[model samples]
Target: MMNIKETIIFAPETFNLAETTRSIEVAKECSHVFHCIFMGYSKKYSYLIEESNFTFIHLEPHLSDKQITQIMNVDQMNGIKHPFTYEHIKERVQNEKRLIKIYQPVSIVIGTTLSMFISSRVCNTPLVYIKPLAYTRPYFEEGYLPSPFTSMNLLAATIKKLFISIALRITYKPKSFTKVAKEENVSLPKYTIDALDADYNLITTTPEISQVYNLPDHYQYIGPVYAKLDVPIPKFFDHLPTDQPIIYFAMGSSGSPNIIVKLLHILSELKVTVVCPMKRMIKSQLHKLSFNENIILCDFLPAHKISKFIDLSIIHGGEGTVQTACLTGKPFLGFGLQQEQRVNINQCVRFGNALSFRKKDFTKARMEQLINHALSTRTIKEKALEIQQVLKDINGPENAAKFLIKHFTVT
Candidate 1:
């Protein structure tokens, strides 16, 4: 067998450290390793990758508005060539090819939306995709689906799933069918198709629970990659009343400002010391609020670590966020928007570890109501502990790394 040259790993700016860590682990096993990130490097991330002996290349051009918009649009379209003509495709291919050449990787692994789009277009190297993990099956099984198109049945419940599938298929033509084939010096298929035809499709999910999908032979479920960052707990947490059960309210990155404010208000009225991590979105607004002694406005804190202290978590159901909460065994009050998030929220609800309120349902009254309900429900707590034990039993990251090494045979 021919020994592989350097393998290039491409990820978006928003790619979490856990995913990055997993990628680096897989890359280290290969002969030589290189990386291309869409955004500039953080010292922490740079140090980690360097420690693994991989050459890091932060491709700044890929982070530009023009590039981001182009990539987002391509994903929104699902890889289909609409709006963008063949001429536009050619232009983009030419532009991206310059960066692709610099890395000179034998195989490329794409883990973020932007990187997925670019690699689909310009690189002829073998491709692998690492998707976020799926929620455990118990979560999906417990959700209530209303019946009939208009009735309160499971059929009604599946409508959201149906529309999401249609929307995704319509917008982003599968990269495999459109870009990958074209770049491989092969004929491009007429429409967007599944990503299975790639050299490998390593989904960040457990095989025991993934829903039915047309996955090809290359597909493998590698379980969740939970990233952790160290953060100091505020002195205030030590002073909070020990008797009162703590409830954490955080709407991960990209959460709506109005919702954050509403949650804060409700928590204050409830007299709960809610910890809200304000990222770039609502950081300024977080300062304006006159927080009661019960509310903690945190700019940056490691949520997984905090989960060990809190009784319940109110979140905007991102996969990574939910997985961390679950691993810690805290029940969730999920508020989700996008299709994937909704699915995760539904899964949490099914497992009896959570209850969800869609973004449309996020009103001050509803927030208060959900918080009250969550606090009152003993079953939710019991279920949370159950799932926590299950997650604890699984060696997620190490198992994922072992799978990649076994399948890819880096040595």
Candidate 2:
């Protein structure tokens, strides 16, 4: 019931809402000028989809958790497997092929530049990659202001890069990638990183967080894209002390529930006031747990809204949450739950505005130490102010939307 000529296909390859949120903001921002048809697996973020302002196409072949676990079992890193396999890509292609028949789009939007690339190529549509992270690796060149994110010397950084490169080389079989190419009836470059080659690379981090590096002209660095909601402040927040800075805390969905519970209990005794937002299940069980009035529990309130009112944020190092914290020039304690998160939080620490901890090594004492450390120092806030101005000058959604419209305008 929509014009195929005006619609843009936005297909998120992965299931993580953290990454999907970037495209959501961009689409909502520009949905007036251009119609965006969201195409993907639905069960990933069914909660927010109903409330979101966009049309969605549920791809064929629903995947149960058990099926997802089996097909995606090989070469698990950080003890977590990626969301794709030879079989998953085949299903995605079939679904996309069906979508093209119903509504031919002007162009296709992508994140992580994975399985969808094959379909875009077949349709002869321009593909736009919207990355929530910086493509630039932290360079520890001699005499340069060492980026603490890596905590490595030039040699160490190089070695780490090589090691990771090797890991990527062996992570999947050549036949797995080639099989997708065969399905598309096209030849794809051998390397996995080649997937990044696109009509445009819309990088979504400020240059302040990324190391200065020469990139292809197609790569444009837009600042962080954050979604805003108009929700009323909870009455519980008003009861907390306005006298001093209150801690904004979120453990994220990645942590073990038991570990999360233990950590929350230990953090409850802090002398300073804290605001923690988490799942309803945890909030329901809080009656059995003990916490002072100083620590307040909340359920899925808008983090951006709550961000402005808080002095410091403690997060699980997801891109969207970290970006939200930075936009406000607020200091934070980042507890990275996985490799991707560890890298993200490491950059924040290296940027000199935040603290980073690995979930494996992060203990209650370390959490207390970092919280006190971030609050006590004015330098953290000062450093955050440095990036805050840069982010403010950069309009993430508008710039990205305009660029896409221009590219597909002539189509």
- Across 253-328, the per-residue lDDT of candidate 2 in tens digits comes to 4444555566677677666677876655275466677776777777666777665678888887777778878876
Question: What overall lDDT goes with each candidate model?
Answer: 0.57, 0.67
Candidate 1 lDDT over residue span 1-411, tens digit each:
865444354443332344465565445434332333332222335455555554565533333434434543443343433233344444444544665676555455655533335445446656666665332222223323321233556776578467434533543444433554365465543323333234666666554334434444666665665555445776666676777768777765435577788667767876466777754447667567676777766665666677657877887766667777887687778876454566667666767888888656556577677777877889987888887776666655555446544554445
List TM-scores for all candidates, in order. Answer: 0.73, 0.84
Runs of candidate 2 exceeding 4 Å displacement: 1-5, 65-76, 80-85, 133-161, 164-175, 243-245, 252-256, 280-293
lDDT of 2: 0.67
Candidate 1 at 211: error in angstroms?
5.5
Best by TM-score: 2
* Clash pairs detected, candidate 2: none
